[model samples]
Target: MRTGMTLLIKFILTFVSAFIAFDLLLNNDISWILLLSLVAMLINYLIGDLMVLPAKGNMIASIGDGLLAAITAYIFDLLIPAFTTSWSTLLWFAILIGIAEYFFHLYLKKDEKVAP
Candidate 1:
């Protein structure tokens, strides 16, 4: 149950960040942007949030998500011209998403740490 809720939050955060980046920065079509966001969200949640985060901690997990976002965005840009953006823009997007993911990570692991 907790995992499910965390998943939902992760998905929502990824979707919003990706959607804004693709739609505003790249000038992509709404439908395709939505689809891309969904795919990215799922990938990040499964790999970054669920798998790597618990084992490695927030910084590494966020970096993992950023890398995942960059690679995913680059691949999608290759497949769809409208989704294309400059490398700098993609880097910025990844950074912003990574910061957000850090906070989400804290939320997900709030009870996992013992107080000193």
Candidate 2:
């Protein structure tokens, strides 16, 4: 649960989840999805994890992450012609990312505790 490790896991999870989520939900170019995932992950980690998690709790932080993911995806889809998406698709991506984020937030918390 060191900072480095946590960030690594966060990046990996974000990348994988976003990649797969978009792949499953949208008709889009792989390159566009990858780019979008990186952007979303950066924002999610910065705002959702760094900002929200410390101020709020895991649930709120996870929700925030989901919201951020949904917004990011929507914006990207609008901007990128090849990235197609819908409301239901966005919600599905959010839900999936949020569940994964919850566990990542838990991992952060575990890192802070005193080991027995």
Task: Report every candidate's CA lDDT.
Answer: 0.78, 0.81
lDDT of 2 by residue, 1-116 (tens): 46666666777787677666777656567787778778888899889878898899999999989989989999998887788888887888799789999998887777765221
Tell me the spans in candidate 1 whose CA falls farther than 4 Å from its real position: 111-116
What's the TM for model 1?
0.83
Candidate 1 local lDDT, 1-116, one digit each (tens): 66666666767787777767877777777777677767877888879877898789899999989889878888888898766767876887698679888998787677554221
Q: What lDDT score is found at residue 96 in candidate 2?
A: 78
Overall local distance difference test of candidate 2 = 0.81
- TM-scores vs. true structure, each candidate: 0.83, 0.86
- Which residue pairs collide in model 2, if any? none
| Residue 46 displacement in candidate 1 (angstroms) | 1.5
The CA lDDT at 79 in model 1 is 90
Clashing pairs in 1: none
